[model samples]
Target: MTMESATDAAPLRTQTVAVKSSFYLAMRILEPARRDAMYAIYAFCRAVDDIADDEGDRAQRREALDQWRYDLDELYAGRIRPRSAFLAGPVRRFGLDRADFEAIIDGMAMDVEEDICAPDWEKLELYCDRVASAVGRLSVRAFGLVDDGAKELPTAPKLLAYHLGRALQLTNILRDLDEDAARGRLYLPREALEEAGVSNHAPHAVLANPALDQVCAPVMSRAREHFEQADLVMAGLSKNAVKAPYLMAAGYRSILDGLTARGFAPPRAPVRMSRRKLVGALLRHAFL
Candidate 1:
């Protein structure tokens, strides 16, 4: 029922760095202690996400996520899972919020539902808030982005996190449209698809539809807008805390740019930047 925190177990530094994601690399920009603690959160997220996406049985996945919630709650109560003991370090030290984690589980729960249909725009945004922004909020806090001599309100990091998270999630939706559709998971708004002249929700049909580009236009536009908003907040934050997020965003933004360059190409091949490009961005921005 309970997941362990970092304090409850030895920090899984190796496991965190093993994932080989842009975010994984960017995490290195943090000081050693914060980076280690972040691994716990990242590992937790990776586990839960895999459960929702990879588990064939929805009920089983739900049970696992629920167990994570219970673990998180138990963590707050001072009990610990030897495996998750590492999480407690960040939860207590960084003030990682409980609500955010719950929201993330709720988002994953959405994917497990029989109807993974894309609802209205508002609902889709809410989904992004849960799955992406919630994690962002926790990440920003871990990097100590919330305070710059208290010059700005505490909400600054959250604003940065939310916008960047939305931008990333929207870009992900665009990039994975064909794949997600094939999996019976369309994150795009039904309204957008309908407006684009597509009536059926089939992934292949959506990809083959001439109106695919049209339906995707608004999603693309919104992603760009969110990126800009993230930039605005990032501008207000101090350089130290912003570096990790900036580098991470750059990596993700490149995917959006790649998708745009390819005309938001279908699932045939995903629109991904090369490792060299991502690593180059990391080296270029990690210090700046």
Candidate 2:
């Protein structure tokens, strides 16, 4: 299919949804081709995520996810369907890993299979890797860190993906505690819950527990460490190479800082970067 068809295949609705996302600035700042590729990836992610979170029947959701996997298989086998045609160019041009795409599907499957609550640290990290770092792995290629047709990614980009992905995901977990609890989901590790003497894993009960802040302390600390590691990795890369990811890290770190300042106590106000702060981050990363 022609690039025009591929571009058109990326639904306008998905682009609109992506434009309203927190990573809008990060994706927007890329060069045209790279930005398009990133948007395609984001659209793919958003579609599957919606299915995973849908209140529909589990079997239908699983069937939907399976259809995506079939489409991916088609895309890889040089048979592009209208639904996934947009990804063909990026996948070929950037040498995007098929497994990374499948990992994302698998990650969504985790949610479909069960609502995760207080998983152990290893399981939590695996969840983070599948859902977040796998996306980062795909993104680093689109960002031009790994050359086209490269056999494998370099150590630094890989590490950057590993650290930044987990950093961002953990921050999300901390920031969305109340929202997730409202949906009967809790992402805090079981070890942390136990360490904090939180016995109940019921989402609302856990949220109402006075020791929630204690349970969150280790998670916050871990997120900070991952952000620090991401910073260290970014410092070693070319400034031009890391501009988008740097902005993402900066934006998310600001949110994490806001969360820390807001504290995990009851009545936690929703934390977000103001438009002015977002503009400041854009200017700083874009031109400075």
Computed on alpha carbons, the lDDT of every model, listed in order, comes to: 0.76, 0.87
lDDT assessment of candidate 2: 0.87
Q: Residue by residue across 131-161, what tens digits does model 1's lDDT show?
A: 9998898888778875422323277887887
User: What stretches of model 1 exceed 4 Å from their correct place?
Assistant: 1-9, 13-18, 147-153, 265-267, 274-288
Ten-residue stretch with the least lDDT total in model 1: 1-10
The estimated TM-scores of all candidates read: 0.89, 0.95
lDDT per residue as tens, model 2, 1-288: 543345554535456767977898888878876887788889899989999888789999999999999999888888888888878778877888999999999999988998888899999999999999999999999888888879698999999999999999999999998888776679999999999899999988888899998999999999999999999998888877788898888888889889888888888889985566667877876665
| Candidate with maximal lDDT | 2
Question: What local lDDT does model 1 show for residue 185?
Answer: 75
Leading candidate by TM-score: 2
